[model samples]
Target: MASSPLGHPTRGTTGTNRLRRNDRWIAASAAFRTAADPLVIDLGFGASGVTAFELATRLTKVRADAEVIGFELDPARVATAQAQLDDVRAGRTNFSPDLRVSFAHGGFEVPLPAGRRPAAIRAMNVLRQYDEADVPDAWASMAARLSPGGMLFEGTCDEIGRIASWVDVSSAGEPERFTLSLRLAELERPGIIAERLPKALIHRNVPGERIHDLLTALDREWERAAPLSTFGATQRFLAAVTALKRLGWPVIGGRSRWRLGELTVPWDSVAPR
Candidate 1:
C-alpha cells in the first residue's frame, strides 16, 4: 500500500441523488449482495457525504449489514463529511440516524482499518481529470484492496446523474465489463455517453475503435426504437438494447437491466482498439 493516498483531490462537486443510478447498480451487484463484509467504498465522494449516506440507505435494503465509507484525499472534505455524519446522528437530517456510514482520508490506496477489504468500490467521476494513461495504475491500486470476488466500478457521470458509464474491474484489476446508462426519457442519442465514459474509453470513442462502433450501432438502434417511445422511454431503451444484442454487439444483461436505461457489454467489446 502507498504511504499516502495515491491520487489528487476531486473538485468536491456532488449533490443529492447525483449517483442514484450508480447506487441502484451497486445495490444489485453480486459483489455487494454476496459479500461477507458488505462494505462498500465511495471513493472520491466529493464535497458532500450525502452520496455515501444515500449509498448506505440503498444498500442496506439489500443487506442490512451493508456499510459505506466516503473517502477523500482532502482532509477538509473528510471533516465536512464527518460534520454531516454528525448531523445525521443528531437526527437533524432525514437520513437514518443509525446509517452505517463513515468518512475517511484516503485515495486509490482505499485505506481501511485492520486490513479490511471492501466488497465493492465506487469511483464515479474520480479519474476524469487524470490522464487516460493513469487509469491502469489507478484501477490496480484500488482493485488490489477488494475482497475476494469483489469489484471496482470506475466511471464518470454528469453532475445531475442523467448520463453515466463505468468499467467493472475485477479483484485482479482486469476490466471485466463496461456499462452505459442514460436518462432515456429525453435522451437525444445513446452516443451522448461518450462524454461521460471512464477515462479508459473516453478518448477511444473514435473511428475504427470498438467503442465508436458500439456507440454508432447504439444510436442507430435507439433511433430505430423511437416508435417505442410512444409507450415510454423505458420501453424504447429496452427495444434498443435488445436490438443491439441481436446485432451481435456482445450486450450483457436482459430487459430487467435495460429498462433502467442501462446497457452493458464485455469490456473487450468497447476496449480501445
Candidate 2:
C-alpha cells in the first residue's frame, strides 16, 4: 500500500475569499512570478477548493501560465474539491473553465506527478492545529519539494480573512521573512494578529520574546498615529508602519504594500527568543 499523508487534517472550514489577502501576496512574490514551471501548491486546502480557484485566478492575471494544485490528506475533502473543480470545468461556477487548477490527495509531502517541483506552496491556516514544535519538520518536508528560488508561504489567518500572518521560507526550509496582514477597516491594535500567528511563533508571544516585542511596538506606533485615523485607517496603518521603520525595525516593503495593511519584516526581527 502507498504511504499515508504526512500531516493531520485541518478543520476543513473555508470560504470563497477567506484567503484572498494571501493570494495577493503570492501573486506578487518573486517565486511565483519568475518560476520557470510556474506551478503552485495549496496544501491542506480544507473543505472547499474555492481558495485554490481564487489563487489561480489572481495569479493568472500576472502570469497566464500559472497553475495551482490543492492538496489534502483527507480523501473526502479531495473528492469534495474535485467536485467543485468539475463545476468550474463545466462553466457552472464563477471561475473560468480554462483556469489551470486541480485537487490531489496528499499532505506535507506535497506529491506531484512527473517529478515536477512547485514554484511556491501556500499553507495558510494549516499549521495552527499542529503543535508548535512540529513546525520545523513540516516546513522542511514541504520546503524541500520547492524548486530553486521558490518559497513556501505558510501561516495562519482568521475565518473572514481580516487578520493574518505568515512566514516566507526558502527552499532550504529556513524562514526568510515574517509578515502580518490585516483588513484595516474599523481596525483596532495591530497586536490583534497575536491570536493568529503561525505555529512557530504563537506561543512565543510572551514577554522577552522578539515576537512579543514586535507586537508591543506595533501597538505603540498605532496609538501614536491615532491622529491620522481622521484621514483613514489605511493612512493610520501606513503611519504606524513608517514609524516602525524609523524606530530601526527591519521593516520590508514600501508605501504601496503598507497601504494594503501588510507589514513585512526580516525573520530575525521576530524569530522566537
C-alpha lDDT of all candidate models, in order? 0.93, 0.94
Global CA lDDT computed for model 2:
0.94
Indicate the residue-level lDDT of 14 in model 2: 92
- Listed per model in order, the count of residue pairs whose N, CA or C atoms clash below 3 Å is 0, 0
Over 46-87, each residue of candidate 2 has an lDDT whose tens digit, in order, gives 889999999999999999999999999999999999999999
Candidate 1 Cα outliers beyond 4 Å, as residue runs: none
Among these predicted structures, which one has the highest lDDT?
2
Instruction: Give every collision pair in model 1.
Output: none
Which residue segments of model 2 deviate by more than 4 Å?
none
TM-score of each: 0.98, 0.98
